[model samples]
Target: MFAIAAPSASAATACAKTTDPATPAAPSPGKPCWVDITPYPFGTDGLPVDTSSLGCPAVNAEKDRGYQSQCYLRVTSMAFRAWNRGLAATTRFQINPSPPPTPFGVWLFNGTRWYPDPTFPGASTCYGDTVVWAGKLDYWLIGGSLTGSGVPTVCRYDGSSFAWQPLEIPAETRVKVLSPEIASVRAGACYAWDDCWFFGPEGVRLHWDGTKLNDDTPDISSPSLRGRFGSAAARVDADGHRIGVAVRWTSHSSQDGVKPEDQVRPDPGESAPAQLLRSDGGAFAPFPFTPPTVPGPDDPWRTNLVAVDLDPSGRGWVAGNTVGAGNLQITGRILPGRQAAPVVPFALSGRAACTPSATAFTYAPTSSGLPDGQSSYIWNSLSVFPDSGDALAGGTERPAVGGTSRNDNGYAEPVLTRVGCAGAVTETRFREPDPTTNDAAVAPANYRGSLDAVAANAANDAWAATSSGSAIGGGIPTGVDQRFYQRPHLYRLTDTAKPAATAGDDVEDRPFEVVADPPIFVEDAPPPEPPPAPDEPPVITTVPTKPKRVKQKPSIYSPKVSKPRRIKGNRYVMVVTFRVRRPVTVGVQALRKNKVVSRSGLKRFKGKRGTLKLEITRKHWPTRVRFYTRSGSTR
Candidate 1:
């Protein structure tokens, strides 16, 4: 295992690149040009930032608007970390749930001082995204908390102090809302949507007033409907109107690896009862989905969406995670009228998947292995920041932005890259020497699936949250062995009046570390219990257990309506690796006007090669399907 060193005065301290990458010109890996994340030695070789008598950091800005600038990061000593077991306790990579929640804040860098955002809401708020309204630049947001755990509140960052201002939605309006993926325009108020989260069987959307943000079911082409949503990305569009979107991954029966904890209600349609819904502003008509483009069978799962900025002019872009099945294709809808989707061409191979919901368990690939020790907890939320465009003649276009790449160390940190400007999703490894990793862990050095949420601000900065530590000593991720501390890591990358740093210089800068409040102790507790085996029947046997066999009849492919299974949105997967010899193939389908519109598909091959394309597939979402050859079924 090679290690990344801190930037030093001695001889440039050079080392080997983690993965092989092409030029940045490539759109999808298939494209001729693509670029990998260039590394620099700015980190402290995993050392804590020296706060000392130096007190808090002073506010700083980049030198010129075009030359190289740096944010050499610094982690606050008060910061907590939860690594190893805490992350894997759940089957998927998500935030670790604490019996008692902790509230904390991290002061961020805006050139100079580390600004602060107070504690995370109640217990349920861990996994989700954040949104910053750049139009209101002096302030930013740190929202996307969970329901019951907390209402989605926006925090204000005024250089020094941080405070929480709740999003105001009219009470009594029962719209189940999740973390909102938002986008702000240099003009108009910001707009956001809840791609996932639901109320009484449906998901909802909201609006953010500078003071308090809340739910505002924007009327759409189709009636605002509901579905299962997961990861989503956003950007401003060509119109300058803040046209953002949220995505939910849902299916008829099976979805993701587990059965839907609950079912979707009020099918998008009613008379005959439509299944999906879309919104325009006044009413939510039936949202007509076209079999939108998706990365192939091997890519990570993501839905395509676009947003437009609004004001004296207009500008913005679209965002979608490109790594599908194996295609790694993401696109942008910058041009108005009829614009084609841009396919990202950088293919990162090692990422593999397909964990099916109970409905499609039989179809998952047989031998695919998961990133070691990784488990996705909750689909925390998505936050879109207001786009602050620079002045230009002949109407300048809105800058496009998207997802963060994981450093080799395994923790999925973020990066500020060009979604359409440069091409392909920017990436690195979740490896050691990461200036990040301020929490404890479940297993030693295992930081993959812990984060439950992700958020982004106008200046191209983003934040991802997860629970890393707990109450006692030697728990999942206790002591100095911390990693994700069940806290939010506020990471920001800005395009200032400074020149961009070379790949070398970029890696050497220090990341500003924000310390947060201690975990909050949750009230109203419930009794803890045991779970069941994945494929086996319950061992419960008593009276009715009197082995009674009825004459079972089988004919037409009558769907086998089995009893529902129990899952805590609580448990985590054990740290384990199941590998596949090759890549698995996947198929895709789109829905619109309450009917299936288009269908496309791609393939993802497997590999350990230093450099490879990692495309997330449609099969990985809602129905996170994973194929297992030995079981002769998917799970």
Candidate 2:
């Protein structure tokens, strides 16, 4: 219920430590020794800079990167850091998805810095472009996107800088590609095989072996049913060998061919697929699954399996959201194997009972019951701790209060869910410092944000990157006009630390130790000078010239009237934010009190997207102005 205030000096305000009780300070409660790398500095929140992916790959033995732990973060620009160094280096180029068909760029960290792999085209074009180190010292980049010809293309790259090649699969006329995943079969060994799976665009599946990419669409036995559709995959491997994968699928047609309106409506038969399969290099072995029913006509009925991994027992544990209408419910499943039955309530305790709409559901703990009326709980990233076998999930919590669901209010808060190896689910929340107290700023006050990527290190420490809103409009209004005021923040969750406990049956209320990186800095241009007082309208004096009568009735001649010359100040700041292909030169002219004060030299703005403030000032307040880029007039 607390609010944040705008900066007194300028409309541009960033989330930082505040002295106000309403907005607290950060850093003190944050995890100790967590790295705080700066975000991409060239652009505003959205365009050129985007921290799209984060990974804490095991330090390769080949590269003695003196650090004990290393992290790679990719935005449209790429950056990486070795924990021991405590500093990050970034690429000069603002990576953007090249036009359709062209591969996006990919960067690699050799040891201390990051370098773009020339073998790969533009910056990573899609989220699926993931780097995997399997058998030998080599690595692979699996990526997917629609080609210019509209053909869905999925390709891979070798770590030794080999050219990217499309996975060889049976060519179908048209297929939409889902995100791709690569499961490492061996830790340090090279010859062991890794599995790459791609699903979607009508239940089509691409299974890539170490040697070739195969169209494994036939793995679905029920061809008559509507094809499976979903974008998450989890494969469990044992001793450098493949075990199986837990995939979520929705059947187009069940035994009962219900009407389009009737399908997905609150019904017992609405249950969908959450199957486990073991493809032994030939065909897929199937296991039975019962999707939970929906809660209401507008609630979730069908299940979606997105995150999956194996428990110590080698049984399949999967996590996903059940969504429909406007509501969403998190769901998890335990696959006992081909012949054994699936367990309904394997993780998280609440919402165990069945509903007409959603037969199964997982409970998410929140302080305020059910969140804002319009809020939805999203659980996107999940990983298993190698040391304790516990599962960690991260996502965004968008409360319904403050601003409407359609508005920027209800800023998102990052949430981490810990599913103990024994299935005890607990939720922890993190936010930027409020300047008042670090612990007081547990949730963001403005704009929308979410956790996009998450990974767990060998020490059971979890790292996540979240795109959250700037503290622009918690309760305070900066009166600045802009489409978005959001930025990204990185977080580290330490398992060994315990948070000050709170009282509640809801597991989410429990405290947990977490450290947040400094918020990405976004400069706001001061408000534009109030439009120069509009020039006064000319006044017409109707002198006693009523005598001006011409032939017919009277030929009325119009008299030329001139408005007083308007004089205005010269100093003004022209703020502009835009994305570009390459840097362009900009010129500005300032007039003070009806006279030219200064003309700035041509300044170049680097592309893809950047925020620029061209300030022209003299003794008087700036009034009129002219601006130009090489392309021409910058209106």
User: Which has the greatest TM-score?
Assistant: 2
TM-score of every model versus the real structure: 0.35, 0.48
Q: Who wins the lDDT comparison?
A: 2
The segments of candidate 2 whose C-alpha lies over 4 angstroms from its true place after superposition are 1-118, 123-143, 172-195, 219-240, 251-274, 279-283, 295-301, 311-316, 325-370, 373-376, 399-411, 434-447, 468-484, 494-635
> What is the C-alpha RMSD, rounded to one decimal, of candidate 2?
25.2
User: How well is each residue in 82-121 modelled by candidate 1, as lDDT tens digits?
Assistant: 0000000111112324322222223223222222232423
Q: What is the lDDT of candidate 1?
A: 0.25
All candidates: CA RMSD (Å): 29.4, 25.2
Q: Candidate 2 residues 249-352, lDDT tens each?
A: 33332222223432322223434333444333334444444544333333233444445544323443455554321122212231111111112323211212
- Poorest 10 consecutive residues of model 1 by lDDT? 80-89
Q: For candidate 2, what is the total of clashing residue pairs?
A: 42
lDDT of 1 at 606: 58
